[model samples]
Target: MIRHDTPSLMLLWSLLALSQAASAAPDTELTPIEVTASPIPSVAPLEGQDYSASRVDADGLAVFGGPAQANPYRALDLMPSVNLTGVDAYGLSVDQNAMRVRGIAASTYSNLAVTVNGTPSSVSAGRGGVGNLFDMENLESVTLWRGAQPADVGLGMGNLAGSLDLAIKGPTEEAGARLRTSVGGDGFHKLFGRIDTGTFNGGSSLFVSGSTSESDKWRGEGGQSRDTFNAGFAQTFGERGSLEIYAAHNRFHRDEYRPLTYAQSRDLDRYADLDYNADLTGVATTDADYYAYNSQHFDETNLLARFSWALTDDIQIRFSPYWLSNEGERRVGKTDKVMVIDIDQEQYGATAELVAELADQTLTLGYWTQRLSSMPPPMSQKVYAIDKQGGLVFSKWGILADMGDRAYESPYLQLSGERGRWRYGIGLRYLSFRIPGITSYDGSGLPNMSHDSALSMNPAVVAALSTDAVTLDEWLPTLSSRFELTPALDLKGAYGRSVGNPWMGPLYSVYMKNRKAFQKAGIPLQQLWDDLALETSDTIELGLEWRHGSLVLTPTLYYSDLSDKQVTAYDPAVGVSYLQSGVDAKAYGAELEASWGLDRHWTLIGSLSWNRNRLDDDIRAGSAAVLETSGNQVPDAPEWLAKLGAEFRYGNWNLTPIARYVGRRYGDALNQESVDDYATVDLNAVYRLGKVAGMQSLEIGMSVVNLFDADYISTIDVGQDDARPESIDYYPGAPRTLALSLSANF
Candidate 1:
């Protein structure tokens, strides 16, 4: 059904058309034309910033061999010192999706700050809730700053790791529409469409797009479904001034999958979920029924507006305002003491920046502020009893658990200047946190007489669980500088101090009405809060950059000291988990990246990273015992990582192959259990069809991931009590997969 020589014929026709246009006569009566001088290269080295950064443009994004419906984070894995695991080619059915930077370990709260169009996108500490909010079809580029965040970036928390910025695509100058469809293994399928309105109505344009996707689990017993929409509008006002607005909404639902222990994974059939029969009793059915009766649902909406104006020939001003809302819930089986966790949040923020040219130097001043609040309604849990059929039986009435209003206000200021071969900048950020109050009631939204009677019977517990209004404040600062060594090289360094505030989940636990239950289990409630402290880190970095005609190389070395690191420890006596600030640690590493353009049709890219981390003090499990983790390598910190890739293009076809290697890692702070290293290869190809049967443009592509089908551990449950042989701690990587996609533009 296809011809190999058709591409050559199309190319011949295009050359003939261009030649004919060149031979046509020009209009002699037109006024003389004027030419303007060319501007400087946009990618040139900056004078005032000292940090490791990378950018993946639209053209580079197209070469990724992952699934068609994969999230943006999947592409970031190619960058230096970045790793993501526990997802298939489609980036769905994630059992342990975790992202780490440098040598830092992933946590319940994320350490990285993620943003879209200069607006914060991450709603929690450990994850980026907005990573899947927009369709990839509408993205222009993704930029990552690895070590120290820029002064102008506005994030209330989680900036200690780094930052990721997503820039949205702008409307095209010409009107057009596009449709795309994809299919792959594991019953995966997706459909997407977009429309762009050309410039009209006094230099204004608009675009809108939507997509839907669904896929069967690659190796588990469940599946995932997602729907998303995006819209944008841009308008030009006064000379050298413009305004733009963007909005997005997304909904996601998926079944939950738990990890497997090393012993259980020996039997591949039992790697994902445990099997159980309803007729069994007294069989400890928690793990067996977890997968069958657990699921999660999420809904989010984002709105942002940006404005830019040129006040004079050498002065400019910019402003951006945004609003976001999120609603999420997780449901579990009735066998557990807790049944559900519901979250509702609202956030709004604004940023203003001014730039001026004075005394042959560029100066910048900016301010950012935001308000965030989380207000969830009352929650309840019921007592469960097993029936003869092995099903859970619960009473109609349930106990109440209400989380009160918690809010925060963040403001920051930054100043920077660049002149000749020198650049410098400094910034300061302040945070004000408030916890108002807490309340409790029955499942029917009324006072629980039984709970009140119990509290009266235990007066000491009542006094300990009383809520109080509290406020906390913190300050952070950063300084950076750069100097040019020669026309082709530069030297840079920076020093930064940042803080990580305790998330609301842990703070709210201090006022839990069920404190008596935990105390009875030997997890003293007062001890959990007595040692709580804000996490802080100081970092120093030095780097070198060299650039030539078609090659660029960068190498960076850095060290970080962390104090009062937040950690969670298991209490075997209570059979529960408690939070504490347990240890001080240090991390040091080197990152190297290079790119060479062999020719117009051949290119090569590679990167290498080496890291080392260790605890400076012994880890204390509780007041009476110590884990003896002093001088031990931090868990989950890999010593070496490498990536290599090449691209080739000829006529209408393009091909790329990439390889990644990960070194061995430990699963516990004491280095008792080690996970083996692994490597994977991926290949991708694309062909373009020009002006085929009334279609303006058409493209077809195929991708193969994990070409060798390597078996490896995708991620480990860090800081686990490895002494327990039954602890499910490892997630298996996905097997080899193939996918195909097609798109048409008109």
Candidate 2:
């Protein structure tokens, strides 16, 4: 258990004991101190292919700032063709953060495949997503792919946009312990510690880490808190095979910041400090806006294991299996009451990969499969009444259901070779999806009761209803080539196809609301579901790389043809809106990145990108009416983005400053509700203290985020391009904040 009341005092006592012990010990050789320049992000091809990939190592993450070091999504803010935004300095608000790669946005249902240590992760996009699972201190590097990915890399339900791979640091061979603590603006405080057990007995090593953090909202009345624990063990079997196991648990709770309208965001001077109501009124309707009523909670646990063996000198096999358990609830204040949304999910999967060396070429074959089960279908809602004493009273069930079993399968193969100055590769992947049917309970007229109790009271078949299942499959292929023009220059190109899962959440909601209407019309709802197809994209890209003594430059261009995109359609027979997959889209973009080492003490990196994602034709709103969306850009997609950063080191001090700009964007499909462009700057400084209290190393860091305090709309919550103005939401960016941290290695 964590001691929340006196964390600082406990750490101080521990350090004092270490200091007294060191003073009495005999003289000994101290570890050497290294003050090297910070590492810059590397934007290069992947495995001799032309895919635009970027990698940020441990040092690179440090240069991005302490917040970036803690948040994986924030670490990609300065990378080319990526955008990330949040409301808190520490990125603890999981439900409010937003991320976009290229022109694709990631929301509750994102189309980006995210993985950790080569295993599928973040299967559910809501409630803090991937950031809540592991601390950045446990990560060695983060790699991102912008365009079409290789056959073996993208392994999940959605891969149409991109993929993010996180590599965790393994147990070290030497025994050691590290401790870190930080205090920042808005009553923020955090403590983290890790211990590594050196190889013992035979060839086994173990590691354990834990952290506790809490912070007050920058502009609101409430705060956020989180606790995490991680453990791992590894063993080597005489160099022929290895086994590893890892486990993690996290619990997060936060009071969300309220969003504003387009007009409200424009008047920053008057509305910058506006937040959720802190005091409740006697009137139930007025008290519905209370800050305590609008809060969220997330609790999750995960376990993963890997085994590898070498069959021969030319062949090797590896298998990884993972399991995840997640439960969360979000409470929102309504006009007269509070609504609670709950999710309980369990996911289990495995991946087996084999590699063989044949002649001058390398071949890889892999298969991946996963099963997801939801006891109460994700996002199920319940209503509650507020008592005069400000307590919650159970009202009624808003949505209740048990989702059927969902399964996925994929088998992929890839081969690559290098001949002379030309290198090439070809790959193919087959994907299959089985969407779960749902069994919904009739709770409209019933009180808040357990599932078993409700069923027993009803004692009739009319209490529950079930739907038919749907199955879909697709084939994806990839081809890539590279030609060396000179020792310092190279040309590369690639072509691939990718797919995205359909909008199932909205579809299920529509069906539940209109089940009787569908039955009356002699439509089983499966008729509409059977017509739904997965979104697919075929992309082609070309690029060139130029490298010199102290500078590296790369430029890339890509175009994509998208089919069966998810869109909303109005059905007059049911007099309701339903999700349909028939829209087509086209996207094209260009990106350029440059890195230069000005001198041994300084390094600079800059990037610029221009993207255009537009509709190919008009959208059908009804059987006879059409929405004029042709030639219009997608909502929330910026046309231009630019970033610049520089790092300088002198003796034991290192300073880094970065600037970013986001171009204008529209809020609706009709090209109305335009948002203005904005720019912001940030600075971070670190000073090495060598050794203290017998510790091998010590460092102090200071960071100032949003240095200029520029006010702008950071994220817009609009799922549909043809959304109404009242439904669109605008979230303001975080204000200027400061943080200080201390780290020690013993």
- Tell me which residue pairs clash in candidate 1: 109-125, 109-126, 110-125, 110-126
Which digits, one per residue and each the tens of the lDDT, describe model 1 over residues 1-746? 00011112232243334333433534322122222322111122222357666776666666651565447666666677876676556775432466667766433233566678877764552222333777777888777776665566636445666777778898777887776778888877776777788899978999877777777667556667777778899999958899999988877776655556766655545554342222234343543254444566667789988999999988889898888887765556544332554545667887777878776556667666666655322233334444445454554334344444445565665666677888776777766655444444334423333433433443232334334545656676777778888989988887776555554344335336446556677554344544455666788888888888667777889898877776555455554445556557787899887776666666777788998777787655655767677777676667888987777665567677889998987767767667778899988888776654445667898888888888777776663222222443677777788889887666
Q: What is the clash count of model 2? A: 1
Q: Residue-wise lDDT of candidate 2 within 701-746, one digit each (tens)?
A: 8888889988988887776555544568778888898989888777
Q: Indicate the worst ten consecutive residues by lDDT in candidate 2.
A: 1-10
What are the lDDT figures for the candidates, one per model? 0.63, 0.76
Per-prediction CA RMSD (Å): 8.7, 3.2
Q: How high is the lDDT of residue 542 in model 2?
A: 93
Question: Who wins the TM-score comparison?
Answer: 2
Q: Tell me the TM-score of each prediction against the true structure.
A: 0.83, 0.93
